[model samples]
Target: MRIKLTYESLDGDIILPKHYNYHIQALIYKTFTPDLATKLHNVGFPLGKRRFKLFTFSRILEKGIPTKDNEKLIFKRKITIYFSSPIEDIVGNLAERSFKEREFKLCNKKIYISQLEIVTTPKIENKVIIKALSPITIYSTLYKKDGEKIVHYYKPIDKEFSKLIEKNAKKKYHLLYGKDAEQMSLEIKPLKFSVQENLKIIKFKDTIIEGYTGIYELLGDPELIYLTYETGLGNKNSAGFGMWEIWRGKESDEDA
Candidate 1:
């Protein structure tokens, strides 16, 4: 489910750092029941053996007038948070806690949540073009001559990245449904992909990781299609990566 969280800046303007996904995750955890929060965070489930996040987010930035302290950033007072998971409690608990607080902290800045509204109309299809609200991050390790390992981050558009998306999708499916990961039948083909130069970099933990946000047309199982959209398509979805929606073509229903 997608939620529009309207926040008023407690202090003049709200300025967030690049790769602000960590901060948003923090807000949800603060409002969660201690036990539930621990489960999602630790993720002892099977898919989590490799540590996959089950949620993604839309950018939480609003253009604002620049202030002297931070001339580079505009004052932003609003943001939208998106949550997609098979577990009802994960979604329900966060929604309840957010409503209760009504006002809370984000990125060390205090803000009041004036409004919370659902913004999702789910449509599922076997083959659909999905648009990313958050960047899709794919990671692979590069082996050097000396047998050292180097991790490389990739956008979904890369030729070899489809396997990464497919593997992650199956992992998530198995993790949630308790299906055999090796036997699951799933296909994800990248029909089309668009890339932006610098907007996809994410700050994960301490490192600056780059990713891409755009439209991708992928063909797969109907259940997988919806799950891909819900659980997010790529890495760090729980930290705001690979969140998507079904792409309705330019023609409206009336036009169609």
Candidate 2:
């Protein structure tokens, strides 16, 4: 399920950390019941050695602009966010709390949910166009010559990018349905891409992550494609990465 959440500040301006993904994630956890929150935080659904939180959210969207320095983002009035998950329980918890508790603390600023709506799910097919609402990220953990840990982020065009995404999707499928998705096939083709321009650098607390945003063509099994839509593509999805929406071929195509 996917939902659109719009928040309006009670105060004049809404202030947030420039890198606010961690705050957004914290807010999401706060919405859940304590038991649910603890479960998701301490122990999510397990598949082998890895755990899947199974939820993803889009970047905060706001029309008003304010000053931006090195540490904070201040916006006037309203902001919109998109949240999605294939698990009905997870979506239910978020929607229920968000609606019941109209007011929320985004960082230290206070805001209220002005509107909450369930976004209609688009039909998935073997071939579809998508645009990232949040940057997509995939990476490999490695050790340096000195035995220090490092992360190597992959570009969209890198062979590992699509391969890892497909592999990750299957793992999600297994966790969701308790069935192996080895038969599912998926491929990602970049339709609009530029490394210098599309690359996004984000900070989650002290850790830095790199991701990309662009239009892409997805060719795959319909089920797996939908899974990517709900659970997000690539890694660090729960940290507000890899949320996407189907792209209409033209502006007027919405009614078609």
Candidate 3:
């Protein structure tokens, strides 16, 4: 089976640290038939006594811009896995079962299995691809009310912020040639939020970048507010993806 995973930055404009490296490792530990275990172990998959081959995999870093108050600044990375057997049969009998039997944590963040899709290739290839979507929500601590006990907070989505987000989600540019004109391109959305006040509060929501998700804290600073957006996937390595890539009002006019 051949699997291709693509990660694209949905929003934000910040550059990720070059030293950051995200790692993705599969854990296959469970009671399996001796034959099956041996097959998996031989391929280098580290499945108890079984092994599996590691095919093509890559990590990509991209950029995005936020258009809303709660929009997320993000960076994206996609991983693809190619196996020798049918993805359904392999993932169903082995992958799914293994994940359930063991505890897998990425970047210390608990992962929630999102979706599994089986894709069929053309006759020339005659292959099947199983795509699994998993997401990890990185949470910070935030107080529900002022002076209240600090608790873990996850960003939530709000529909009201859509209009505001749409109006402001644009790539900003400052022209250096001729008359120093300002330029903007592409409307962006928010994917996640981080709590500025409570570092333990983590929030998730599905909304376009132009929408409003609600306010957590107003620390009297315009740039220090917290908001919510869709969460990204994280791996064992320090490298990961984020949604808040660009600032809401800091779009530049430079040509890429």
Index of the highest-lDDT prediction: 2
lDDT of each: 0.67, 0.87, 0.26
Model 2: colliding residue pairs? none
| Per-residue alpha-carbon lDDT of candidate 3 for residues 182-218, written as tens digits (9 for 90 to 100) | 2322212233333332122222122111111211211
- The residue-level lDDT of candidate 2 at 233 comes to 95
Question: Higher-lDDT candidate among 1 and 2?
Answer: 2
Instruction: Report the poorest 10 consecutive residues by lDDT, candidate 1.
Output: 247-256
For model 2, the run of ten residues with the poorest summed lDDT: 247-256
Clashes of each: 2, 0, 66
Full ranking by lDDT = 2, 1, 3
For each candidate in turn, the TM-score is 0.82, 0.94, 0.26
All models, RMSD in angstroms: 4.3, 2.9, 20.5
Regions of model 2 farther than 4 Å from truth: 63-70, 249-256
TM-score winner between candidates 2 and 3 = 2
| Cα lDDT for residue 48, candidate 2 | 86
Model 3 misplaced regions, further than 4 Å: 2-22, 27-89, 98-103, 125-256
